[model samples]
Target chain A: MYWNEKHECIPREELEELQLQRLKETVERCYFNVPHYRKVMQELQLEPEDIQSLDDLKKLPFTTKQDLRDNYPYGMFAVPLSEVVRIHSSSGTTGKPTVVGYTRGDITTWSELMARSLVCGGAGRDDVIHNAYGYGLFTGGLGVHYGAERLGASVIPISGGNTKRQIMIMKDYGSTILTCTPSYALYIAEVINELGMKPEDLKLKVGIFGAEPWSENMRKEIEEKLGISAIDIYGLSEIIGPGVAVECQDKSGLHIWEDHFLPEIIDPETGETLPPGEEGELVITSLTKEALPVLRYRTRDIARLITEPCPCGRTAYKVTRIGGRTDDMLIIRGVNVFPSQIEHVLLETGYAEPHYQLIVDRKGTMDTLTVMVEVSENVFSDEVRKLEQLEYTIKNELETTLGISVGVKLVEPKTIARSEGKAKRVIDNRKA
Target chain B: MLKQLSVFLENKTGRLTAVTEILAEYNINIRALSLADTSDFGILRLIVNEPKKAYEILKKDGFTVRITDVIGVEMPDRPGGLNGVLQVMKSEGINIEYLYAFLGTNGRGAVVIFRVENMEKAMEILQEKGIQVLSPAEL
Candidate 1:
């Protein structure tokens, strides 16, 4: 719960020495072997000799998501295509997807990081892991799969969907560690209720949920329903997927692997590195990656850095709960709002359900905000007047919670769209 | 006495008007009504004239109908009139959740429709107190 300056906890001279050694080798590997790296360095008027240590990373050009898209399929691969054994692509919801390639050694390193993540969540050799993250191009599924195997635990690659079958396997296998997106875990809990099954019978001990940002309120809900300690794992396909950082049992924040990937928080507007505990965009430099080494990649995720040693004895740097993406922030009537803020309001309002949609429209020059919420069954009553009263109560509570007036529309339960992966929480009609 | 009527309606907007218009066409009066509406389904409640004949006519017109026994009680038009009824129900352990009122003839009294938690207990207590329960005809 408390944060200490971990990087300073260690001798600064020693940390910098270690970083310089890793930086030297990475630069040598890039200049001599990778054509893309060589071309980028030459174009930026830089050489391996000019980059003496990790402190000189600022001299290098920063990589963006658009850079990956520009390279397309194999343009970013540092080695020959035959040396690459695996490939993964982004969700491609916004634009053309960025593709990543990994060599056999790269996978081994990935497995090791994932193993560390599972161990951080207290998964040992005897544990049975139910891996429910979506498979194929997404790294969540296979990323957890190899990690569980490396940890010498029993791995069940459920690969998502079919809640009934997922439960059957979970109950039969006695899964101790659950791995999937947080939304899918909630969906599985819903199925368990529909089938009239008690959660105590599942024997799940821990859950590693990621792939999208979630609030602490969601963690408590999942824990209460499934009777498991849910932990957050943060990653992206471009940055070696779900093993980038993980929550220790303390559940304070996720521990980023500083040795493997260097993390820096930068102001999105000024592009200057901010000090620890300051909220800004996360920029990462892969110190140990081979086949496709990324230099100062801008992740666009907004989070504050915690440089403290965890009670669980992890000395790595931790990042606060991901506030949201810089791009996902919406401007409604000139008020900057993130979907997480709406989630916070809904969770605080005990009468409102999580199944709500934000409707945004432009009325001439100003933006209008309307929230459509599905009434929870606990508030349902036989009297029509009470239903209307409940609607008014929700409207007032939300207006007070968000500091902005919003129209509240109550709808029947189970009328909203459901996703087994990444729940769509916003509906902006202004652009449409 | 008691009055109960069932009004039939389709699952559409303004369908309730059609049912009310039909009752108006026959000069039959309505005291109260409750409606349960789903997107594509609806059930209408009514306390109207000739409850039995209305049910038969509505059923003949391809409308589902049902009937319930709702008592019309006459009470003094004073402040404690409704309080006196509630006090008795509370003593008898009966809860009234929802209710409606009907217009009474000049200076005589008013009729109230109550949906109580325990209907049988409420009727027994009122009958024992020598209170008259009006039938649909009085309305």
Candidate 2:
């Protein structure tokens, strides 16, 4: 049930010592090689030696996604191009794609971490992993591929799309493990239902889902529909991709690999680190990355860190599932709202489908939020008043939860565009 | 009591046409229909010859369709015809949620569909008042 037990379940003091050592080495590498780090360090009048303990980690400059974009192609890479054996870039749908490189040693470390992640999610060498995360450029597919290979498991690199064939192969090949985004997994379940097939027809036993923030309700839905234990795996392309942390079978929270990546929660507005168990922006520092050494990289993801020991017995501290991205946060008439909060409300209603889009428009000086949710069979009624009541109920629940009265629009089924990758849940027309 | 098919539709052009086209393709005749709409969405209530079949076809075509029991009563097909029925329901304090009317042939007179708060109470009152309530076969 455990992979790399020494590092995964290391004693608290021993793990801290290992983290400090690796942190020091990574800082020295960044200072000597990456000019961006050196310039920022000199501006703070700080040196690598100043990072004597993990507490000094706060002194290091925070790196943003813009910083990586400012560095462009390979500027943030600490090692030379020859040393970097592999390169990966984000989808860059927002702006410029942030590129990351990996040295051979970094690849090995990533593979080992992924191996640990797979085991943590209940996959073993005997499991056949059907990796549906896109392969090219995106780190999801290949990151999982290397890890499953490293775990000595059979991997079907059947990247995303062609879902019907993917399901066919899953059944034909007897794939025991599935790895993809949470939304994509639900789409697969829908397709299975459409094809008149049941989850029991497949041999899938475990699924590792990530790359987007999903609610616990989604986990239950996937578990029931797919007949598999859905495990949440957290990572970003900036860090080592897809294997930074993973939920053990305990399903409480994801265990961060403290030996390789140090995790912290910081107040997003103040940029000051928050105490454990407080919700804020998650900041991570890659302790052992060789090609690209990131120091206190601001993840922009909203989550809390739990220092309490998990029932799974992994000594590495756990991070609660990501709440939402700071960038995805919407300011409506001075009230902060996250789409996930709306999604949670909709899912909890049991009358609405998971497909919903948040549309924010500016009416003169006031910002208006209209939540368009697909009308499911359960909510539709022959009586207009009853249907209107369903809408009013959803609106009231949303207003109570979000503290801002919102317009609830009942859209027809399949009105929301379904994405095979990340689900696009928000459309902010107010942004100019 | 007759089964009426109700579909949730977005208030957009061609949505009504789309529903009708699907029903027409299945050779299902819409005897009487009423569209109730708001700025964002609409619910199309239909009294079709084959309510069960129409509901299945529309539902399989990805429409949010529902079937509900509604009363169909024969009217005089003249001025103030619906008023007389409403007056009868008013006397009994029976509230009508919604209603639509259509002409009937073969001397069956005009038929008015009634969706009321209490279907059985309205039916008993209408029957006792000597107003002819048409069944699905009569319609």
Candidate 3:
């Protein structure tokens, strides 16, 4: 099915006019339907008539993850519960889950966006798409599933786990477009090797990896191993799940659906807007969301905006690589350690797989960070002492490089946990 | 030839005793041991009766220890003896961070455990000076 393009390539003035009109309608709907939005809007003294133009969007109160938690389940829904067709929730590690409601129309819009993302990344109508994303309250699985189906591609609803089965179906179905996180894509390649199968024997062509921040080093690794073009897709559950933006063939940055969502880069510390090409936190406001319209939502993800029209012919604003979350930065003995920084060091080492975990603990009041990484078979040796020495050497190298001491724990191949959805790679146990 | 076993220890009182106890359990004798302490931690370097075996025993007892092949020069245990080695190293562009000599040998010779910043360059310097550099087997 063809998606609407009236919002896609419209002129700036026309798009802003449409956004202002939708902003007024969304404000009135929220004020009449959702009590939480009413309270926040009332606190800001913002009436539907006050938002006469797109510039007035700044007057709306910023919504946060905490706001979603305060208004759990259906508290943020702008429509009745009976009208909602599907629901998705966050990881819920912090507290009660931040639930998202999708009406039938919302689901259709979501599917259209995902289809656009897949097509933009070079998926064909006849190609079979393998959906390895999980299929529950998580949006990665079903989001891609419906998108592929809507695009008329044969859908393999293989939800996570069972690497052997995944490979079997991938080969049997002649899948051309693969959708999964980059780490899981690597794990699949490993299983293919263990089963004495060559990656070139598979008919896969493209990969959409997202839900967690991955390095370009990993993208090249995945592409070389699986013989497929890898693309980084960006989305969060608060913003109607994973199809919000996707990378085109140019592999520069993800092309966001600016017609439906307005993208802005803000200084994470000051909440002030920064120009394009400057690194800052991303704040999105969904202009056309019907059931759950979010205004000035703080994503907390660190990245920059690219307003330059991409060489791939898409006029949508692009977001560069997301650095990391602000609050998740770990301070180890006065040394700040972000997982991406550790990933950067590991990628620079070029010895281990992309799969890794950071273990942090306090040793006599001093923080010590230990990296658990898989020893690639290319560098594997049977001598345990030699391996131990290699670990020590790597630890010393990382210590010298990052200017902070780190211990390296080399594990047997495939020991670290793999996820079909967002990969969890960091574990910090320091109380401070 | 002499070998040195470097044991990592926290700057606590009984930590060294625990390491020594592990060595004693394995019946390993400490020929020459030097303790270098910083404000945070300490490195206990020992010239053991059996360097390899002592390192293994300590490692098995959960002590972080490493064995390195070090050159044990036969010096006269006098001030000029160390100066002679330093003059050769300095002329050969070798920088020694830390070094220690074993005592109680009746001033026969100084078995020095010296660490050069660059091992290959230091080995080249010693080779050029015709000094005896011991390997792990020689140690």
Candidate 4:
């Protein structure tokens, strides 16, 4: 199952050396070409030469989602626009998108790494990859597409949605691997049963699911429902799409492709790197990307890195699957929706109290986003028709702003729980 | 008009019994009780001897309690007696959100507690039509 053991299974010392070399080169690239990175580096009086070893990585300034947002479309690209062969972004409803540009060589590197990731997930040239990640601007579809193609696996380039069609194609083609969000995979399994088709009718062996945070119970649910090994894959458009790390057949933790993306866990509040195995926010540095190589980019995904040797034999570290985020960002149906975004909409509508809670739950196979808000005592005491009309107006305004339909629960004042310091704004029952 | 106590309880075993236990401890006689439920929670509406006292006790016990205004309509023990009040309500466009009944005190007749869109108007109309409308004192 090892596609490129030369890089995937590099010895620890050699891997660190390779990471340091690539880190140094990427630092120089970012510090010279991109003004944002250059300004950030010069602010600390830190030069590329200072990062002679990987330990000096802490000296470099940490780039954040705000940094990517501040430098909107092409400001973060290290290479010139002509050098960028493709661009991908995963934008929220309100603000600027987190953009990633890829050079031709960068695409080749991504495909190679994605191929390695697929091999780790027990997929190979003989397996047919049902690439269900979205295509075009969103990175998942094309990322897995090119990666499966590079692995010499026959790829059914079927993008997300169209559940019945996907099942039909999968059965007709005898596709051996399914690729999409974990929730969508469950929805597909549900559809198979609705069509009176059993899991045995389809020849699915492995699933490469990512683009959202999923739980172990969800993994088991998918495995049992689809009669396949559900492997977790992790990636974001800000770094490279769908193949930065993946769970091997051992099903322990995600084996991060450390040769390309150097992973770190840092205290989100103090900006201090925690010891390995301690739960903290994950930060990644793009080591080999040519077009938009990032330095210590704060991923905001909370996880622990396991450096202990794994049965999979990949010396690269694995990150424990993330269960929560450091920020109040809620990913609803693959779209990132912040509580502040909903709050902003509520405030702009001029109809609700500042207090609100985002209740996220799994309604069957789909994620249900229910925004709970408390109204003024006067508003609640009003006639039922007025309250219903106000709820309608608030739902409409929120849908307009957040670009997603949400169940609006209007309660009386002082109903939503308040806090002393940080307000607990999101209650995600999906993990429970 | 009779004051009905509505208590919010989580949908779990022994929760309803716990509420009943609280009522029993306070020696509150439950005249009529109805339970409305959803998946996560349930609303228990009770017309007791002293709704104000029952509401205070439930509120002290950390239950979300609301004292609502409802009129008790005395129905003839016969089957059409219940339909008579409903027909009047339907003609007057008085929407009944919910209704519950209990045997009349002293074995006079059955009494139906009605939560209507306009409680005052329904009471006036029922009394004008020679229908018996029980007051809080009577209950």
Candidate 5:
């Protein structure tokens, strides 16, 4: 079941030695080649030799998303442009995009991590991986494509969209493994229902869903609807794409490939690193990336790290599913709200589907939140009073939980725009 | 037994039309209808020629639809006529959830569709009180 036992399940002492060696090499590479790292190290009066052990990692300066953006195209790259083999950019939905370059060795390392990622999900050479993650600059599609090929699996690089054609190919090609965002997978299940086909009819037995924050409730919904084991794969374009970590068959938490990317959870407000199993912002240091050697890149993604040995037996540290991104949180009338929180509420109430959009608007100086949730077909009621009761119940539950009043707008099924990659579930119309 | 079609609708511009259009496609004639809207959403109650068929088609089209038996009671067109049936129901300990009326026999008489807490109990109380409860055929 293990893909790379030498690295994936490396002995603790040996893994630490390898990490320290790699960290030292990376620090030396960055300090000597990349001016950004050199300036930061100089500002701290620190040298490459100063980072003696993994514990001393705290002494080094932290790199951030803002720093990456400041670098723009290739300012943060440790290697020369001629040596870099591939380049990928962030989604840039928020602001200016951050670009990353990969040397040939970096690509091989990424592919190997992805192979280990897929193997963690129980996908093998015999499995037909229908990679629905979008291709091109996003890094999800090509990142996973390389891994599927590396794992000796047949990859259907269908990319994203064409839900009908996806199902047709999935059935005809006997695709055993499905890879896409969880919401898109749910949409596929909805389309399958619309086509009057049960999940039992499909050959798909497992799913690789991530690239966005999703809830446990959503995971269960996807699993039951698709009749497959839906596993969450965690990764970011800044650190690496979808193979930075993955949940093993245990379905407990995502096991980070500590051999390559070292994970540290820190208090978002303070720079102090939190203890294991404490939730905070994630900071990653790339041990193997050659072209883009990011040192303690603050991922902005919120998650807790678990050092406990997983039942699946991989010794790599596990990250409890990402809670939400620091940048993605919405402040409504002084109350912080996350779309995932609304999703969790709806699913818990059993009144709405996984699809929903949080619309924030403003009148004068006061900000207002309007939650548009699609009514689940299972709970749709013709009785106006019952529907009203359900609506008020949901609104009250949200108000009590969120500590702010919100307008609940019940919408029809399939009305929310389906995402091919990451589900865009928030629309903020208030003035910035 | 009188079949009434209840359709759930969002209080949007064309949602009512959307439901009507589905019924129209099935050639189901809506004899009388009442819309109760509460800002966020609305419920369209319909007395159609083929209530069961309308409910089935609307349900198939992904609309929240239900077919329920509502007793249609004939009342005098004059004021206080509606109160006569309510008084009897209250006296008989029968609870009325909701009721709506429409002109019957060219505005000569009024028909009140009673959706009660217990349809059989309300119907029995109405029948025992010598009130005329119209059947599906009469509508």
Candidate 6:
């Protein structure tokens, strides 16, 4: 059940050789075309020729989300705009977004990689892929769409929302594979029960879920409710969308496609690369990207790399399901939301520095973000309408900025606990 | 016009009790009270005998409290007595934000507290309409 068996099952030595060659070429492209990479390399007194072996990747300066943002909308693109056929953007910490471009060749490579991921997750040409990931500026929807088409499978491209219609299509169209976030899968399962339709009525067999961190208990729940094999896939827009890695039928760990991307684990605090099987921040280097070839991009996602060969016979190394993030970024319904973003909205409301706390919880199948702001003397009003208006204003501003709906509550003054050091800002009740 | 102490309270057990306990400790008698609430939190509006002392004590206890000026009118305790005051305000085009009733200290009729948008206009209209408007001294 492998797609591109040659690359998936490449020998360890041969894979290393391919990775090294691609890494050098990518570095050269970045240095010659992208000024940010060139400037950083020059500052470090390093050149493209300095990267002789895979270990030399450490010598290269690490790219960060801030670096990409500093470059802005098109500065990070190694290729010209005419060569970049498609563009996608992910949520950034501040107001600006992290934009990614894909050249025609890059699109083809992404399709092939995603094809490999879908096949690894037990999707085939005969399977009908019901892709529920979003389809706009976000990468998940079209990423899976192109790959499903490349796999020669029937893709529904339903995107997200309209759950009842999706379920109807899943049953009527006889969709065999479900692609969405793991929490969404559970939600669909709940909808199935509420409609009095059993899982057997649907033709679903395999589910590939990603875009948010989910627990193993959730996997078990989805499997039991939907009666399908739940596989965890990992990827980020900065690292070429959803096909960076995926779990095979083995269900142990996601096999990183070492042919196109080189993955590394590093100590998040010290920036030193950690040994294999050691848990730290996962840094990725795009080995074959034409539009944006990132050099050791700090993902801010904490994970470990497993070099042991999987039972599925893929020689590519596997990474455990992402454990946590090195920062306080919350993925609410697949949208990245930072506490600082909410604070910016609150502060921009023209009030004095207000005490605020973010309460993240899973309400049913959806992730809910509730912003608890203390009702300070400056903002307090005797009129209930005025107070309610303040709450509405905060909610509207937060929704406008974060691009997500949030529950805003005006609690009593000093109700939010104050810490002596680094004040606690978020209370996430979602299970790890 | 009468001073009313309004305190923000979260919808949790012991929160309302905590406010009451603090008020009792400070010897501030709640002459008239009304609690407006939503799902998340509540606003406890109170007409106390000593509003300034109550507001200070509640502020010291970390309660988001505000002192608001409201019109306290003495109305008949009989049915439709509230309609009389409402009819006058409706005719005069004065907006009442919220209103609540409590027994008057004389124990003869009910005293209705009205939180209006324009306190001066509401007081002038009520007095011209021959309504008994109780002031802070009377409360």
Model 6 docking category: medium
B1-139 in candidate 1: lDDT tens per residue?
A: 4656544333556767767776787777676666765443344667776787776665565444556566668898888887777777788787876667765776668778776767777898888886767766666
Residue-wise lDDT of candidate 6 within A316-424, one digit each (tens)? 9999999999988888888899998888888888678868999999988888999999988878887778888999999999998888889999888777887884557
How many clashes show up per model? 1, 0, 0, 0, 0, 0
> Model 2, A360: alpha-carbon shift in Å?
10
Of the pair 1 and 3, which is ahead by TM-score? 3
What is the descending lDDT order?
6, 2, 4, 5, 3, 1
lDDT of 4 by residue, A190-298 (tens): 9999999999999999998988998888999999999999999999888888899899988889999999999999999999999999999999999999998889989
RMSD of 2: 16.9
Q: Output DockQ, candidate 1.
A: 0.03
Candidate 5: give its CA RMSD in angstroms: 17.3
Top of the candidates by TM-score: 6
What are the clashing pairs of model 5? none
Candidate 5 residue lDDT tens string, B1-139: 5888877777779998898788788899987888887887777889999877887788788776777778899989898999898899888988777778888866558998878888888778788899999988887
Candidate 4 scores an iRMS of: 5.8
Model 2 over residues B1-139: C-alpha lDDT tens digits? 8889889999999999999899888899888999998888898999989988898888899998999999999988789988898899998999989988888979767888889999988889899999989889987
Q: State each model's CA lDDT, in order.
A: 0.75, 0.88, 0.75, 0.86, 0.84, 0.91
Please identify model 2 stretches exceeding 4 Å from their true place.
A93-95, A329-432, B1-139
Docking class of 5: incorrect
Clashing pairs in 3: none
lDDT of 5 by residue, A55-170 (tens): 99998889987788788989999888999999998634233567989999999999999999999998999999999988888788999999999999999999877899999999
Q: Write the per-residue lDDT of candidate 3 for residues B7-90, one digit (tens) a residue.
A: 665565688888878888889877777787655355678887788788677766655566665556656667797788888988
Model 3 residue B86 lDDT score: 81
Candidate rank order under DockQ: 6, 2, 5, 4, 3, 1
Residue-wise lDDT of candidate 3 within A222-292, one digit each (tens)?
88888989999988888988889888888888888887788888888888888889998899988777778
Question: Interface RMSD value for candidate 3, one decimal?
Answer: 10.9
The C-alpha stretches of model 4 lying farther than 4 A from their native spots are: A377-386, A400-403, A421-423, B1-139
Q: What share of the true interface contacts does each candidate keep?
A: 0.00, 0.90, 0.00, 0.00, 0.33, 0.75
Q: Is the docking of candidate 3 incorrect, acceptable, medium or high quality?
A: incorrect
